[model samples]
Structures are given as C-alpha cells and as structure tokens.
Target: MAFINGPVPEALDREVAATPAEFERDLRKAWPQGVRSDASLSLELNDGALRLTILLEPLEPRRIGLLTLPRLCARYRFEGGDERARTALLTRLDRAMQRGGG
Candidate 1:
C-alpha cells in the first residue's frame, strides 16, 4: 500500500477495545427471563474473530433418561472473512435476541 493514511486511530482503537465489555454488559441486561440466575454470558476476542457464549436455563424442567440438566448453552463464533461477514453475524445475533433466545 502507498501513503494515504495510517492504521486505525488511537481514539477509534480505544472505542473498539471497549466495545466487547459494553456489548457483554448490554447482553446480560437484556437476557431473557427464562435464563437461570446463575447463567452466564461472555465474549472472547481472537485475532479477527469474536466468540459469544450464552448459557441458558429452560423455562421448564426436562427429563432425559434418568438425568436432569439445569441449563443449555450455545457458543457462536463470528470470524470476519469479508466486510459483510461481521454485519451478517451481528444481524443474526440481533434477530436471535429479538426472538428471545434462552
């Protein structure tokens, strides 16, 4: 690349750095009521990837064989291979949240 502009600005870098924690906090606040009190929501950043984990508890009890599980969990990993990949992943997460995923 030639000389046009440098890397991401320091202020933008700080905002980006703070995004994950803010996002996690917002998710926790908006979590579904059906989720258990001990359920956890976390985010992990790796290179160009973002990993979100949602641990949920069923609204009602479930019995499988003779064992009973307290909650169910899912991990969604978004790796930005292209410009639109990140947008798509975010849209997917938004839809899931609107649908009350728990």
Candidate 2:
C-alpha cells in the first residue's frame, strides 16, 4: 500500500530519544514507593523514542450488603513534546490510586 505521509514529525525526538531508562531511573526520585501493583505502567522504546502509558483498574463495587455501582477506568498516556505530559499522566494515575483508596 502506498503511504500518503511518513511518520510523525518527531515531537519528542531529542528529548526522549534516550528517555525510557531515564524515566525509570527518575521515577523513584519522584515516587519513593515505586510503582504500585494495582497500577500498570508500561514504557516503550520504539525507533529511539519513548512512550509511556498507565492503566488503573476501576474500583470494585462494595459487596457489604450495600448496592454500589462500578467505577470508571482511568488511563493516561504521555507522548510528544508537551511539557505537561508526564506530570499530567502521573497526576491522573495518582488520582485514580487515591480513588481506589491506595
């Protein structure tokens, strides 16, 4: 198949060309407890670039003889050169974790 255009214009090319390792190394500096088990964090190094995704499971409905509804799922991603990407991702995940009572 012919391609109309090529890949994205390296939004985070230089900044994250070698960021995956740096991210992992620096995560602990920010969160001393490391990543929690209920949270799923994945970092990918593709074509000399970095991308991060975090998924937090929804809260389970209470089963203590009280009617409860399912919670919403929370997922965040960090891509491109936006300065707030990482901060936003962490904030969302942290909020999710808090909602989960962790």
Q: What are the runs in model 1 whose C-alpha is more than 4 Å off? A: 1-40, 48-61, 75-79, 82-102
Local distance difference test, candidate 1: 0.35
Backbone clash pairs for candidate 1 read none
* Predictions in order: lDDT: 0.35, 0.36
Extract clashing residue pairs from model 2. Answer: none
Q: Write the per-residue lDDT of candidate 1 for residues 15-34, one digit (tens) a residue.
A: 11112334455454454422
lDDT of 2 by residue, 1-102 (tens): 011133332232111111233334444344443443222334332111335444334445444467654442333344654444444444543343332122
TM-score of model 2 (CA atoms): 0.24
lDDT for residue 49 in candidate 1, whole number 0-100: 47
Number of backbone collisions per candidate? 0, 0
Q: What is the lDDT of residue 71 in candidate 1?
A: 32
